[model samples]
Each structure stands twice: as C-alpha cells, then as structure tokens.
Target: MNWMEDGMTSIPNVLLQNYKRLQIEEKEMMVLLHIYSFTQKGISFPSFEDLAERMTISSSDCAACVKKMIQKQVVAIEQGDQTGYEFYSLKPLWNKIAALFESDARGQSLQQAMTAEKDLYSLFEEEFGRPLSAIECETLALWIDQDEHDPSVIKAALREAVMSMKLNFRYIDRILFEWKKQGIKTVDQAREQGRKFRKPTGTEQVTRSENAVPFYNWLEQ
Candidate 1:
C-alpha cells in the first residue's frame, strides 16, 4: 500500500472557505477534521483520549470541544440499532454548510444589483458635464426607486436628450414619460419609436440647416 494513500483524508473546499462563517474556531476545526478522519477509518465514536493523542489539546479539553459541537447542532451522537453503540453523525454540519453557500450567493447578487443602481447618478453627471443638484439627484432616485423605471430605459432617454441637444433634466423626463405612455420598456422599443417619430412626412422638405442635426421634437409630442 502507498504511504500517501494510507494517511489521506478528503475535506470539502467550502469547509475550508467558510469555517469562520460557521463560527468554528481553529482548534475546534482541527477536532472536526480528526473526527472525520476517524469516521473514515471506521472509528465513528473515537474516545477523547484518542483525539487528544493526535492533537495538542488535553483529553478533557477534547471532550469540552465535542460538547460545544453538540450545542452548535453541527454534530450528534446516535445509537446504532443492531449493536446499541453510539457514533458521531455529521449530517447537520453538511446541511448548515449548504445553507451558508446559498445565503452567500444571494447576498452577492443583491450587492451587485445595488451597485448598478448607485452608478446611475454618476452616468448622468458624466453626460451633463457637471455635478447634479440635490433636487436633481432626488428626481433621478425617484425614477428608479419610486417609479420603478429600468436603468437601461433611463440611459436610452439620456441618449435621446443628447441627440436633440436639449441637455436638461426636463427634456429627459419628458422622453421617459412619452416612452412610458407608449409602453416602451426596452432600448430596442425606444429606438423603434424614435425612428418612427423622426420620419419625415410627404409634405415636409428634406433640407436642413448645416449646423443642426435632425431630431424628433419630443416636447411637441
């Protein structure tokens, strides 16, 4: 038999990554690994003396650590039906670890969403070429938080305002309102509406001032 194979124990990556989150201290975690190793070698209920021999802790201290694990509901001792013998069970510990991973993923997702929403103000400041006023900032927040407007749609409205050379909060607000009224929920829908609105009628001439770009009169709409 290989010397490496005889000594190896398989520990989960999540156990190492999130042991602190589980409130397990360094010494306590070592005890858990020892317990897992013992279980793997067919020693389910290893005595505290056995655990203490492998670790720096005293047998009494090892017993205390086992008590703590029991209180935390991570490990339990159950009686075997055939032999009437007690052994350690790690089912609860694995369940807790799984729940922690799911909770962390949800927290990260929510944090990312909040970061995107917070960046909306900076985007407006960059386009307007100046810092927004307190009132102007409040209005922008209302559009997202209160009115439930999509950030992409708000950005689309900003682009429309820039093209029209209006460059003001009122014009941008008007564009948003018109899009809402027209049931435009996406950038594609907004672009289609813009094309239709700007299309010239048969009676109108194609000529335009050399200094001006063609844009829809959103205020008139």
Candidate 2:
C-alpha cells in the first residue's frame, strides 16, 4: 500500500517520499527525524556514541545508518582529521518535507531575537560585574542556546568562588577544577563547601586576628 493510503502525513513521511523518489529505504525516515530533533534544539550534533545511546542501538548500526543517509543525499556528513564528524541536513529537502507537514511562517522576528540576546549579555554582566572575556562570552552563549547547563548553578558557583577567594580568578579556576574533579556540577556543592569553610571553629576564633594579614604578606612571612 502507498504511504498516503496508510494515513501517515508527518514530516518524516514527506521526507521518506522524497527519498523514495530517489530509490531509498523508508527506514531512513526514522534517522532523519532523530537528526531534525537534535538540530532543532540548537545543541551540538550528537557524536556517534551519543546517537547510539539515544537511539538504543549499537554504534555500528548507527554508523551504518548515517552512511546510508549520506549516500542517499538526504543528509550531509563532514569529517575533519582533528574535529570528528558533523552532520548537516540537506536543507532544501528538509524544508520541503517540513512545508508538507505545516506552514513555514514560524520564524522569529529579527528585533525580538536580538533583544533576547542583548538581555542575556546584560544579565551576564550583572552577574559577573565585569565584561566577559571573549571565550567566556562564547561559552555562555552556547550554554544559553543549547540549555545544556543550568545558569543558576554556574552563577552560584561563581558567586561562592568570588566571595571565598576574594574575587581572584585564578583561585576561582582552581576551585572550579577541584569541584569538577569531584563530579560536583550543581550549585549546592559549592554552597555547602562555602558554609563549611565559613563555620567558626575554636582554632579559627583564636587565630583569626593573626591570620588576618594580606595573602601576599602571609606568603612573604
């Protein structure tokens, strides 16, 4: 029976129909859906291992499917000696597929998009109280776009690190490294550590005055 007879009028079906016109399998439909979902979310395209995990299939199977899609010209795969594989949709074909499923007028206005990005930058400056370095700014932008990590958790860690270490970026880096080594990615871990360090012990009470010297002076002594 024809796919239309089966009443499956989804984007994937449209994509499959396009591929079949070029003599490809309907199974490519599933792989295209997976790729569309991944890219639509603005995440870094998944690695082969990631695709395997998400699809609950073996890596070899995932690789085979990818190769077939590439061969069929429904997907494009780029490989770099250093950077590994990147997958991009054949945009013309995908657009046609999407148009079949729904109207294509769902894009954002340029002004609204720019305003949102500007707001994020403003928030970043307020949180850090200084302009982000280029690399830091790029990292935050990627995080915001992908929604991969929690901004609150990152902000709390930054705040605790700054407060505890007197805003020394080097010390903050060290603290972040240690937390990462311990698999502490959330804010609560940093807060708990800060609380522990701030607790007044008898030794701390007795030696507080003596240890109040500047870090450089203490180092010199």
Compare the candidates by lDDT and give the number of the best one: 1
Those runs of model 2 whose alpha carbons end farther than 4 Å from true positions after fitting are 1-121, 139-149, 206-221
Show how many residue pairs clash in every candidate, following the order shown: 0, 0
Model 1 CA deviation exceeding 4 Å by range: 2-7, 41-50, 76-87, 95-107, 177-221
> Please, what are the lDDT tens digits per residue for candidate 2 over residues 1-221?
68556443235555555566545565555555666766655544666676676776777877787788777555776554687856565664675456644542434444565565676567657766888898777765665456434455445545655456565445544655576666766666656665676666888767976677553211110
Q: Candidate 2's C-alpha lDDT? A: 0.60
State every prediction's TM-score relative to the real structure: 0.67, 0.33
RMSD to the true structure for each prediction, in A, is: 5.4, 17.8
CA-lDDT, candidates in order: 0.85, 0.60
Instruction: Determine which window of 10 residues in candidate 2 has minimal summed lDDT.
Output: 212-221
lDDT of 1: 0.85
Q: List the residue pairs that clash in candidate 2.
A: none
Which whole-number lDDT from 0 to 100 does residue 100 have in model 2? 43
